[model samples]
Target: MNDSAAPVAGKTGLEFALLAEDGPARRGLITTAHGPVKTPAFMTVGTAGTVKGMTTEQVQASGAEIILGNTYHLMLRPGAERVARLGGLHRFMNWPGPILTDSGGYQVMSLQELRKITEEGVTFRSHLDGERHNLTPERAMEIQALLDSNITMVLDECTPFPATETEARESMERSMRWAARCRAAFTQRPGYGLFGIVQGGVYPALRRTSAEALIEIGFDGYAVGGLAVGEGQEAMFDVLDATIPHLPRAQPRYLMGIGKPADIVGAVQRGIDMFDCVLPTRSGRTGQAFTRRGSINLRNARHQEDQRPLDPDCPCPSCSDYSRAYLHHLFKAKEMLGPILLTRHNLHYYQELMAGLRQAIEDQRLDDFVAGFARQEAEGDIAAL
Candidate 1:
């Protein structure tokens, strides 16, 4: 294994190589300008230009090949123009690896109040200052480019859950139109690429139409959005089944903000190459840790006298050196190190899970691997801490 920490730099261009295919699950490699990212990879979200407590070196050590940057957060805080002038996001944040930027569409809809949508784009007030802002498809594309994002997402209105079929169809159609405008605005970069997000709210036919329209416009990748936004797993899986087949197999498929271990496994079984979520990091900060067996809450009183590591099977720094009793004390004392250590452990666990999934796919044993994982999960949550 190449363990060197510095950002690997070279030629750009995504060369997605399918090494193996087990049912819909696949083992592949995504070569980017900075380095090669093994799929199915889970990108740690570094919203606000940082991955919470993790240093870039620590993040790399946790096995993340790429990190996600949020356009909305960066644009609001330090301002995108300032970032551009300071030599873009990579230099601004001191992370030289590849960064994928969201188009700020989701933030505009979710974070801002009284949002008004129109054919041109969305008009909403900034959650930070109540300052008015307009985010059109073209402007979103331009903003990502200005940030020098290796991968940029198209601006799509993330439809809220419990939406009626009529509302879902209308939202899907509008997203498709924005996708077209996003495509037209994107400038060609050898290694950089644009991705179109498919939104259909829980309707199968609408998902198919959205997928087909996005494929027509064409992009380096397709992301399934609007799922996981409060829709249960069964409902989300139904939409995936309806949409994945319509997408081109050669390109990568990303499932945005997708979920727990079970959720990731199900999506991989249905064909997804990339994923991103705040669950692991955020949960860690709250004294929760993920393990091979299941999730464990470190804040539970039962761990006050426990001598065991968080997970004996885990090879992370926290598991290697810290005892559950020590961790419990830290949390009980409200120490910042408690969350930091747990975050590292959670990130390590997620990376290990992804490695296991990739190996299983390559060995054509995904079904068996998934079955074994389910069995482990059934073993119940880890003993407190």
Candidate 2:
């Protein structure tokens, strides 16, 4: 996991290039301490230092240039200090590629009654061992530094959905103040970058204020947060509409925790350059397969004797060599291979979609690409051939 050997000479420390654009959609590149990531990219979530069922090599092979880690999980388990002593997150997780770590503000908010928020920070009980922990903007920076995260996300309140403009404004203002602290706490390095998150629920005015505040504090990247909590896709996009126009185009725009395949497509079209979600791998474990036309449940009886690939267009090892019948059998028999294979295929599907999006942006055909995409989805999966 050592990319420390890459020549740092002449490096601008977290450089970015906007290569192409079609409407609001963009194709960009982010240069990190470890390497460069092509955008619009989907960062596979590797919360707790692992991407669940897949190995690091498998994840890389699936076209993931970057993966995400949660500050809360790592800080709770092996402890940030322990990881630093062992050689940081990339080395500890056996992943050499770039890693982005969330500031854990969202998880702490989820604690509800188990936590208390003050002007300085949020104090919460660990879900792992019921231990008490406090997370502040400064401490968040410290934890990410200890983990040696390439992309450090700032601590921000994840405003709950359906909040009034007043409530949202207060929450968003608090996050803006924390963003200032995070910027101050983050140590500058050659290729590392800290991203400030915009939190204002679904209010356009509040979203603008939050984005403006973060931009003032400055960051290598900007993320649209707090929408995916419960707000539907349209609402999320509305926030992005109001927020992204106010963001710095020179830097990357990341839509946090957003979505299904359609959601990613929409966000990428709306100027988002990065994403992270646990849907693909999690659904795989439950016998769900994400195909071009939508998701299919392998647990269904129709798949018991259906001798076909999960997605004929898919080139993943699972689809290339396995049949729907065999996959159904694996799940029915409770074979471990089912989840592993499904996860591999799902990741491949996601990467392929990203590749297509990048190509579309490069060719200035994003509109056409999106139309064809929706048409395919509407047509549904090819009849069991």
Candidate 3:
């Protein structure tokens, strides 16, 4: 966002310190341009430059240190070139903190009917218009640099599940090649880092190969990709169990585009240090709220006359000030406030959850924390109490 293009000072623009380890879970600190983010942090996805209803200040107030931007979305609308002209993503979005951007490869692949892939890159029709465009690994690196992202992800094919072993291997190899190009093209700055993604379907051996290949190319960080698309939790965890051990213990481990509350906790227990997901924001807009227990649908008739807050323990502005009936009324009447309040509450829950996780890891009681979490989830809504 600064767009100064001034080189970052010092070695390893970003530094990860592994302070403690309990079983597979880790407690550490990630140093970034904005500040040092505690490990096991959940980055709210502010795709297209904003986190939906919440303002940047509000997001910070909720204890978020960093946010995510989508390269594909920004590239398509407002254009990366336009954003660069306006002073990069941070200044443009008025968020001065750290920002991490995805490589735009995932969205391009999702455009199944509009895309064609080759050795060079992928050519796809813009979902917004019929306009044709090409995105290669080099182009993705350049785009992230223009965005002034603190962390940039490598452009890799997110191979979907159920593919044949041959198909999965082919896709994995392509992603590895792209990772090399992406690493070569990345601009190194102090506090800024490029991460390589590991992509292999459900095969343990394939996952190991992907991890080894990315390590050989070398990167500031590493991510476990190509999971959670359709693979159930057990399969995802199994892959993580096999893959995480192979990753460098000193570097931060990121699990991309994953998951529900349970998924986050499970992944963390399996040794993931970083995460980004659209569930909290997207589900909020659809009338869902995640509490200490499980998820709740506010659209239920049970909330019609309920006078309690969404979560009695939650300290978010929404839960602190508004009643279930008020939120329910707003949703029933199709008011924008419903989405806004729910979004805030859900983010608050997520941040609080991360805080709890970090504390648990630091205390070397992750197992106990996880056990308590399960018990609470089984206990159900606190509002009914």
Best by lDDT: 3
Cα RMSD, each candidate: 3.5, 3.4, 4.0
Cα lDDT of model 2 by residue, 112-140, tens digit: 98899888989999887788888999999
Candidates in order have lDDT scores of 0.87, 0.88, 0.90
Order of candidate numbers by lDDT, starting with the best: 3, 2, 1
Model 3 residue 37 distance off true place after TM-score fit, in angstroms? 1.5
Clashing residue pairs in candidate 3 (N, C-alpha, C atoms within 3 angstroms): 1-90, 8-190, 13-191
Error of 1 at 130 (Å): 1.4
The TM-score obtained by model 1 is 0.95
lDDT value, residue 8 of candidate 1: 27
For the record, the alpha-carbon RMSD of candidate 2 to the native fold, in angstroms, is 3.4
- RMSD to native, candidate 3: 4.0
lDDT against true structure, model 1: 0.87
Model 3 C-alpha lDDT per residue in residues 302-328, reported as the tens digit of each score: 899999898888999999999999999
Instruction: Please list the residue runs of candidate 3 whose C-alpha ends up more than 4 Å from where it truly belongs after superposition.
Output: 1-11, 382-385
* Candidate 3 global CA lDDT score: 0.90
Q: Using lDDT as the measure, name the better of candidate 1 and candidate 2.
A: 2
